[model samples]
Target: MCSRRRWGTSPRRGRARPICSTWRADWPGRAVPTSRNFSPWRHFLHELAGVQPDDPVPLDDVAELRAWKERFPTRLEALLGPLPSAVPPEVEVVSSEDCGRYRRDKIVFDVEHHLSSPAWLLVPHDRETPGAAVLAQHEHGLGRGKDEVCAVDGGDDGLREHIRTHRSDYGHQLAERGYVVLATDLRTFGERADWNPPHLYACDLTHVHAAMLGRNLLALDLWDLARALDVLCAHPLVDPARVGMVGLSVGGTVTLFLAAWDTRVKAAVVSGYFSSWASSAAVAWNMCGSQVLHGMLGRLEHVDLAAAIAPRPLLVESGTRDDLFPIDVARAEMAKLARVYDRLDAAAHLEHDVFDDGHRWNGERAYPFLDHWL
Candidate 1:
């Protein structure tokens, strides 16, 4: 059977059904969303919510697009906090393993002033040089870090099963396809989580600490991603000029923002996360702390941030039955962003795949899209 047609027929599909069937909850971390005084609180937030109606005028020229792009990033900085400046740390190899067509290296590097990050760099064997590369970010899955994407040994059976259900190994997939791939853990996962007290989920505690200091995790995550781009470009075989990023869930959240902030990401594929935040975050409340940007809606819509990468090849994947980002909303915002891309005379560069599946990596379209563009 075609794999796409078998999204629901995998051996563990029955066990994984509840992972998506239970809406308002995110898998791998944190609790299900709950607005205690549902109606009153929602209305209260609605009064304060401020996703402005995007400029209706199509950007007819590059100059107009440039103006549109310049208008919002400053406001975003105020909301997400400033993107940091850090010297690139030297890459250290911890281990390397041959994973069939690709060789995987377990490496570590400093992403911030004192923050070290664990990552897996997967490079294809007997491959051509000056080829494309992808910075693949994994889902915001609890305890899942670079290991999940690199198909590294997870030690725990449950963790391995979770990775299987999510198909969260696309970094390995991309590398085996001949693209150099770097999969990095974010702030709260893997060895970085060692600092927090043992009982706490790192994400929960990290959110609290970041907020206590009047900063947000989103800022740090973005800075780490930007720095990682520099490292990816430094790879000898990677075409520094041709790099892209693809992620699922929170990773998709990072993908859109990374592309927006850095032009070095020549192309992108954002899966399972780009929809009307007005509908999901505001109403359904299906968002996490790490993904939040205070007052983001006041200046820009999700589609607008996405369009900031306009005229570049972009493919957004949405599952028709995915509750996290409803298909109707995904299609609506996609149409809106398509118009923005159309302004640059690069409408063909913008596309969306409405998959007949749920929230996971739907690479049937994404892989080809990246290969075509990068």
Candidate 2:
């Protein structure tokens, strides 16, 4: 009355006729709620069809793995750019010679993306028909140089030092054992980079964005890896079916994901990064960096991702004293995966090499596994 507007009022009691009095008659019975109770099977099918699954789906089945892969093409584009084109580079062996008992070379290529993923290909001197090929993945801080790529003597200086001192550089030793070896640099690392901030793992977020062009920095690095594989498989002397990958630390992380995502990778030796998520949760330095994607935990655990490689040949190298990822948790996770592998009757395919040291790859244990599987 005070010249004020009245508040909008609800229908008096229950008596404002429905918006459409006849609308109720459109259905023969009281409206059935369109939403149904949650069904796990339906969710599984939806995820299988490229619709993201509800927060979690049963992780043990091959069907789920296939479905999760289906979701990637759609989701990856939003987070990472289109899959990098796979234009096999014009591989040319620029130089070749003997490095001790092994034959080594400086191999160059004009990769499609101009990524400059050069490598040193090594083979046992005068050996033919090697059992397999091992793509030696280098560690985080080092750029892949000849010394880093072929660290046969086990001395220090980036990856070369890590491999040489550890007696692993499986690239060098594996070649000596008649296994063809291809050791190359991931995108932002090694001789591949002509300027500053040499490695991706150590760079600032801004650097990642500037270099990778809206791609998840880690994903960009791994894509380079897949492209490298494209070249290796084409090698006339290499046994395409007997291919393996091995590395330490972040290299281990790549080893893990590469084996899971690419079935063509028949075997792998992952060191310095095998401990369980629960164990990794404690150590401050153990966490690789802020870039470890936030969504990995919300959806899949490392163990689950490891299990995704079940029935395939996988060798996890863990450090008993390593603070990065706890040893006990790693073993427990391995046991969980063993059950799945057992179901597939390929239980022998999964193995763990527990070393007495911390944060390093145990090369001795790893080499034999490659010899056996590849």
Candidate 3:
């Protein structure tokens, strides 16, 4: 006798049905019944398994790499929808202060027609001529943005603890090293969060609203960052030819994409955010609306995006104890990216700094890497 088991109730009939009915039970000999619990998350994981790009661009050699660079940005821009038009970033210096080793200037600048951004411009007093410059990107936090990167004095205990833990004040560090650093607030963070509802993250609401209008939060951020670059380059102490970028977490995401898309960024240091998308998707809160691009998973991965920055000096930093972005996955992805750099004969230009720490700015190798490259 064959054992019968109830599978699921029928929606229309509202009756329980045996997983193995007579017809299914025997055709030539017998049938096997497979049972499993239903889970949307599990289904999503299954869907993501072994996914690859529909039209993968080649990265075999210099020519192929160049072709991939040319072709991939178009595909990426499509996913990003449209970007705002370029405008003269009418940079205005709001105020300036002489902080021990460097001068900190509060400035405002235009990003788009009606959009503007505020930032901290740190210039080292020792710099005698126009020298290397860096666009320092800040991580995500409540009542925290460029302030964290610039090491501003006041914030909530959480923000301070985060700064202490992550050593989040790399912009100030760069200034001490004689690089003029521009750290700006991405939209929905710090001073830009005025439109946010009480107790709600501004990025969530802005991402939702932008999507409704066929825009993307990241695209908007990239636009603003580009304009910020205009202001950074236009500074008397900055040489446009010697520009680099560095960021961690959400800041790292923008750093990676912006370096890939814009040629002006001569070097980039991406920290705390270099693992695969599949790895990130496993954790529910690891991804957000602002970081998403429509239909990106099947078409691209973090390796591909990082690879696009190849032939250009890039240093990727990963922390062993960073649970948010697992170190093992970052190592695996970096291995894949290494192949692209090798094929381009730019292996020397690529470096991975795996540190014994948590999700934070490990600039042990980063400072020297930028000095060597920029």
Candidate 4:
């Protein structure tokens, strides 16, 4: 037998009453309560706890490290889908100006047959010969893109404030220190942003579109950056052998992956984005589609991907108060990566600069690290 109780007031009593229900079987009576406090995200977190890599890459020795490096990037590239054929950048200088310690030139170059990237090339006045060059990447923001890193004047007050607060003008800083800096917009930003009717920040939309085509927005951007490297290396003022990269936030994501994939980047400074994938995934807005590797979660962690840059000079900057990436996880991940460097006998090549702040660039150690390595 089953009994039901209506919520609120009982019809016969015409007054408020407690609600209850019960069910009785052949043997006895029992009641089961329904819960209203469950969350799907909590279930997902539960599932994530059980997931682990099928074959975590071995870092036992130099042979294993070399073998892993040989095969991992190929696997990663395959996951990213096809890349556009390499072609001569066919660079064009659009304009130039004196900017205190460096001369900034506006240039455009082809990354694909139909696609081009706009950039600012900062060449220091004091350099007498070919010197180190750095690919300076910018974080996500309103329409400033490359301009933020190069510290171009006369943008909106918000942009100016962002630049000041984040210490984001590192490209300009690199120029002042005598390194040639190439600052460019990754797609769907600054001049590359969608300007049509019902315009929106297009990273999510663009990432969806690329995924439909079995491509990734990040892979596409990395290709563009590689071409940008070609342009930087070709510059008479730059020594191709002494190339490095520095970036904050989303820019740091690019710096980490690009330096890992392209050995041409002799040293790298990855700021504000080195925490584990699991940590980033815990926050919904932290992992963007553009930065996603399709099946990478169980197959690897951020440390595994970062280990590919082992034996190479890498400086990671983490802010103690960076709630997005979480400095605690960054420290743990860096410790894991340090083991890989230790195994490779390149322990000195790895450095972690933990500063007391939030998500932003801290060049105190980075500038010196790059100077010593590159």
Candidate 5:
């Protein structure tokens, strides 16, 4: 039997009524209510998720863009909540080893007072000059975490399969190209995944605790990621002026938000997760609590928040058949980004590639995009 449930986005109103898929099993072959005849609130949510939402682009001018940077983050804060300010991340390199073309240093660093991050710092072997760097991000690969991007030994088989299937080892690939690459486990993945929650769902509890502590998962992750920027800048072999970031799935969510919040990122490649938040989060219901920014729909959609990264080099990559993040919505967001960049006279800095593939990392334009921007 299908259980009936309702969700309220605002305190006084239920803005959407998303049906559970349980009905499919309750009546094996009976025709069900199509999404076409969904309630008005659900349709509104769908419109927000699709290209039909009313996000009239703000006029492109120096004044508006400047004001947007200041105002937009504040509005986003209303959804994602407050974050601890940036602090010196006293880094501790735990171990180092040569891996042929590069040496990987396993390290720990503090994001703020209470939390610390474990990361792999990949440096070009037998090199000395300061060069560009990338804060490579990891996706939600069935179950694989940061290792999916770093391709390190001792990773779980699922992430290993994720590596083989998606060629998700962009961090190692970038390090071999002579750029310092920092691949850190996000809040609830890899080393971070093992949590002492009072619930069965560890990831869900972490995000819940984050929200109860006055912020959502995205806010907390971005705060720590900005601190990762501090660590990247402090490294001897990294040129502080030329830092970029890349991620495939949830990692792309971080790349988008972090680049929007932290100005230090000079360039970014967001793969697999640049769709309309509504399209992916509202419709598919495939997002983790870590991806939630409660009630983000009313203020600014994905494209509006991304405008904070305008005038900087950014490349959005998406696959045509990605089940989680549909390419159709990705193009809509891309078009909005292009309009904002074109108005700023920095159109060339923004590029998006829709490759003919599925929901995986297609690194065709990623390396070149960073090379040109950095």
Candidate 6:
């Protein structure tokens, strides 16, 4: 899921020499490189967009998207290193219950993680007709208490508390319609990345510490998602070829990245968070530390990430009143993507549903698209 390139303010569109034979940072002036075949211009392009590097890249065409995603799982493997090819010894399902209205059973399982991290996996009880699974991704911000991503009803007052107070409709709704739903937590959110009380570091200070490793929490969180996929594929009921992903806000951001980087994900729904970077940076007050890139303003835009999902079915749900991402910009960005998908001969698969709301998922419009596609 790539964003737009803010060309006017991006680093000069100059060619970059390889940072080094081994690492990108070793390169000379203006060159940003990494240990792998890092694309500094791509990096700089992200910076120009006012979105952070940890954000997913926008897709431009089916060919381009497929090419980038082909090796994503491999790259992730390199990062996490030889993940459990089989379920971890500590993996266990602790509980299961039927949510009467949705007609799907909610099951909670635990995976003992190496980082001393423990993850809870929630799955819908319904069985798939054939090959199908939906990765119900969660947003960031929760550090404990309750995870709202797993709740079916968001509850009164409608605050959208994630798993604790609501079941992510994106996940459970699809399960009722006959798809195995996989919902899990990302680092620093929900139970996986919870820090002890009196957090070692306050939320606002994450960026300063990220400088120590030349990385950010988003980068690390995404890595965890990639690993979760490994476990998802290992399940007997899961279909490796027909996996799809859906998320809102932060979850939507990761959905874009996961679809772009992981071939295993066949479709995606990027909700509430899809919008043009140019307009977003200019007006949205919600832009946070890692949300804006170091030098992306002049090169790519929000639509680019949508382009990356080319050839694959993608549905973007935008809230008309969303303060973080303008609806008009989202429509325009989606239009840019429509052309790219058309060029790839997969135009029929692209779709967008806009609603009158702010920053929250409409839920009603997105699931049917996933049903039709995956």
Global lDDT of each candidate: 0.79, 0.66, 0.86, 0.84, 0.80, 0.60
Q: Give the TM-scores of the predictions, in the order they appear.
A: 0.83, 0.73, 0.86, 0.87, 0.82, 0.67
Candidate 1 off by > 4 Å: 1-40, 43-45, 48-64, 195-201, 283-285
TM-score of predicted model 1?
A: 0.83
Q: Identify the superior model by TM-score, candidate 5 or candidate 6.
A: 5
Model 2 RMSD, rounded to 1 decimal:
11.9
Q: What is the Å distance of residue 281 in model 5 from its true position?
A: 2.2
lDDT of each residue in 123-169, candidate 6, tens digit only: 44445444577777765434331245555333534435444232344
Count of backbone collisions within predicted model 2: 6
> Model 5 over residues 49-120: C-alpha lDDT tens digits?
445444334755667667666677666666666778666688998999898899999999998777899999
C-alpha positional error of residue 119 in candidate 6 after TM-score superposition, expressed in Å: 4.4
Clashing residue pairs, backbone N/CA/C < 3 A, model 5: 49-279
- Indicate whether candidate 4 or candidate 6 has the larger TM-score: 4
Q: Across residues 1-374, which tens digit of lDDT does each residue of candidate 3 receive?
A: 55544367888899965565434444436544455647787788888886867665465566876777788888888877888888888889999999889999999998989889999999998988899999999987544789999989575687778787888999999999989999999888888876767767778888888888888898899889888888988888889999999999999999998998887899999999999888888876677655777677877778888888888999999999988899999998888788888988889999999999888899999999999988
Residue-level lDDT for 79 in candidate 1:
70
1 or 3: which has the higher TM-score?
3
Question: How many clashes (backbone atoms < 3 Å, residues ≥3 apart in a chain or on different chains) does model 1 have?
Answer: 1
Clashes of each: 1, 6, 0, 0, 1, 56
lDDT of 4 by residue, 203-260 (tens): 7778888888878899898889999999998899899999999998889988888988
Q: Report the candidate with higher TM-score, 1 versus 5.
A: 1
